[model samples]
Target: MEITPIPAPQIDLLLYHIQHHPAVLDDKTKHLITTMFQKMQDITNHGDDERRELWIPADRGTIEDFGDFEEYLTEGEVSSRDEFEELWLSEYPDSIKWYKLTTTIYENTCYVFLDNKLIFEVRPVLQNNDTKDHSELAEWLLSAVDNCLTALEKGEYNAFVADNLPYSKRIGKILREDFWRIFPEEKAAYLKDITPDEMNRFFNLIQTQPPDSPAKRLPEMTHRLFLDSCRLGYAANHYAGTNTLSSMELYRSHADGRDDGLLDINEDSPEDFAAWYHDERMRSGHPWEVCRGGNSTHISLYARCDNRGWWFTLAGSSYSRSVETVKFYLALNDHGIPAFLCDGQELAAMLAGKDYIGIVPGEVIPSYCGHLFPDENIIDFMHLPYDHTGAIIEAVTWHPLDRVTFS
Candidate 1:
């Protein structure tokens, strides 16, 4: 529980993304967002404009009395700052409202009300004393960079990003860096808080998953893991590139088993027909040959992309709708990730309330391999969806890849 003290500029960017980004937000969150901006305006303008209509939400929690009874008590009178203090303070001295305007010049802190219910309060700290001014603060709150999201791009966002980050500049940084690209090195830790639930989810994935380090980890990274028909699925849909690139290499390894062990008896025309058939498969998005060995199966569940590292996690389903949890994990297995940390569907199964989190998996990982990741790992995450929710890492000590296999 340490305070990182994000800069005012950074904090403002975080706020703006959450408020304006078109990501799928929960009903309560969506309601809070609308009222947040409206509250900001009201606070800055001294609450002069009596709201003609209360923003009665259609979906979120309802308010039985949105000050309907209080309006008559005040005779529909607009309260000035002096009156707000005189009347409200006399009635509710212990209320946080008493300190709203007095705490900061422009009321840096204030309660955000929705349907007359206090949703949350904005009590942000200004990093620089110079940022205490109204105009600068307003600019910070309102700044919107064009095509910045495009500029922020590096790799596409996945289910983890979407579910974890709603509107986050930090996610942009993590995506750009591809920090988790390095094998078992750094994680996108700074982006979000690590919850106990997430830690359990990580362990669940790891405890059942197989290990990779070919020479170091036991049972050794085997060729048979891929030599079996799965290499077909692996090569057919694999990540040809590392975590840092936009366009991934689509490749069927030279040793891919696509053309391997062709039956001489099955082909009437023999040699020429076999060559033509293999070529056609390659051209038609199918593997041209069967692969036996030497292809890399290091499927990346996540990675630490760059040196700058992640400070905050970005949110929003918009971030990685295309790549659901299961799909990403399966893609790794398809591409030859022999031992993986976890897959989306299994990860989704651990989600608290929902059977799956983020985007649901469309196609199940084929049965040549079990859908559940069978590889063991040094560590993994357990994600919690309900009751003090979020993802946390569960670390089980296993030797590094440099260690030789004994068993």
Candidate 2:
């Protein structure tokens, strides 16, 4: 399949934002992306099947026809492999937030070939380099690569390679052999190396500290460890406005203690998890003042963890909800609990024994939460309607009394 490469400015922007920010891509988008890469690997290994064997049909069909699944795949559109690739290349940045980065590598350098035919070559690049980094800018460029590689290594690409394509093995092997061919080891220290102070600075940022002096260092250590966990989960998406997780609060009110509740759900909603998460089920935009949703919905609290976490779910309605939307709040709350009400009992079962997971991004230091800050954006991403900067402040404002910790 013929593929149209990503634009130069777009590649640079993504690379820039990730090095400096954290948690930019939401879970759904991440899932979609990993699936897309998986499809890419499958095609690279087995070649186009003509039998419609691709996995991530959403992205491919979305691009070719710009509609839902039935419309795109049912017709003759799938017959044109080139059209499919072009569609994938075009829609990729939008789904995966590609406009945020501007750097590009030509396809030939990344893929491995056999039998003189194209096996895989790291999807062709339509645009090469729009922004150039000299000796002075070298350090920042290396840092950006480091962050990008980390994100990709732990993310969808890792799983896709393991499960599907043998040609697409470790990204490190590709990098050491081909990606860094332009620079020798000494000259590429900026790419291959990092400093001690940089290491300590990174550790200091993600740690959280205790309110009391004795427990302070412990918090910091935990925060650092949580960040490590995120990296391991391949959830380490860095970009502007990611560290805002410290300020999320339940939509509670004082005085009358009201919060415009609006939702209701019993055991008999649709099997899909939507009834519980969306605003439409309540038939109102505002949530009730007392409960999470309308009084109609009453989810039984299943389990409370020693890790300052809880799980409860109601099934009724779902509208205007994206994984990013829920993540938007989670990233804002410092000690926020990761909630997956839509998954129903299965998610609850997973949570049954997994209580020790700590709050992420910030490490618990002696008396303070140690958070690592990203470098300034080498590129920019689109901002949402709400004041994201304001959201950061709102997320971090926690009271000492409200502070809950788990050992």
Measured by lDDT, the strongest candidate is: 1
User: What are the TM-scores, per candidate, against the unseen true structure?
Assistant: 0.19, 0.15
After the best TM-score superposition of candidate 1, give how far the Cα of residue 361 lies from its true spot, in angstroms: 25
lDDT of each: 0.27, 0.26
TM-score attained by model 1 = 0.19
lDDT by residue (tens digit), candidate 1, 299-354: 22211112332111111111122122233333343444433333333333332212
Cα RMSD (angstroms) for every candidate in the order listed: 22.4, 24.3
What TM-score would candidate 2 get against the native?
A: 0.15
Positional deviation of residue 356's Cα in model 2 after best superposition, in angstroms? 18
